[model samples]
Target: MARTNPLQFVQQVRSEVGKVSWPTRREVMLTTVMVFIMASLTAVFFALVDMAIRGGLRGVLSLFG
Candidate 1:
């Protein structure tokens, strides 16, 4: 088993972190807006689906009663 020197490991980690591509403000804002829009649409869709199922179950149960 080869052991890495602690000092060399710290330098390697710093170099890798510096190489990361950070997103610009505009890019971050656009991505956030898109996520919110998709989330809202998903919520609405699920709500409608749930209401439909509840209504169907109630109607079926009413018939049995």
Candidate 2:
């Protein structure tokens, strides 16, 4: 493979970085909020599921004991 010099590498890096479409501040904030909301919902859903399983196990065990 061919190797580039340090200066060429830096130029290439800048060129690639310039081609990127950065997100606006509002877009970032909206996505961040959405992520937090989804995460909270997921956590609550799992917590409820865990409680149900735990309650079921306790009830079954109580019957045998």
Candidate 3:
């Protein structure tokens, strides 16, 4: 394989970095908020499901006892 000098490696890294289209501050904030909202909704959904299952199990045990 061919090897690059230190200077050439630096230049190549800078060139690649310049090609990146970084997200705007507003876009980043919006995406972060969306992720948090989705995560919270998922947590709530699972909490409700867990509560339902727990209640069903308790009721069944009470009937047997």
Residue lDDT tens for model 2, 16-59 = 99999999999999999999999999999999999999999999
Question: Could you tell me which 10 consecutive residues in candidate 1 have the lowest summed lDDT?
Answer: 1-10
Count of residue pairs whose backbone atoms collide, per candidate: 0, 0, 0
Best by TM-score: 2
Q: Which tens-of-lDDT digit does each residue in 1-65 have in candidate 3?
A: 99999999999999999999999999999999999999999999999999999999999999999
Candidate 3 segments exceeding 4 Å error: none
Q: Poorest 10 consecutive residues of model 3 by lDDT?
A: 1-10
TM-score of each: 0.85, 0.97, 0.90
Task: List per-prediction Cα lDDT, in the order shown.
Answer: 0.99, 1.00, 1.00
What overall lDDT, based on C-alpha atoms, would model 2 receive against the true structure?
A: 1.00
Candidate 1 to truth, TM: 0.85
Model 1 bad stretches (over 4 Å)? none
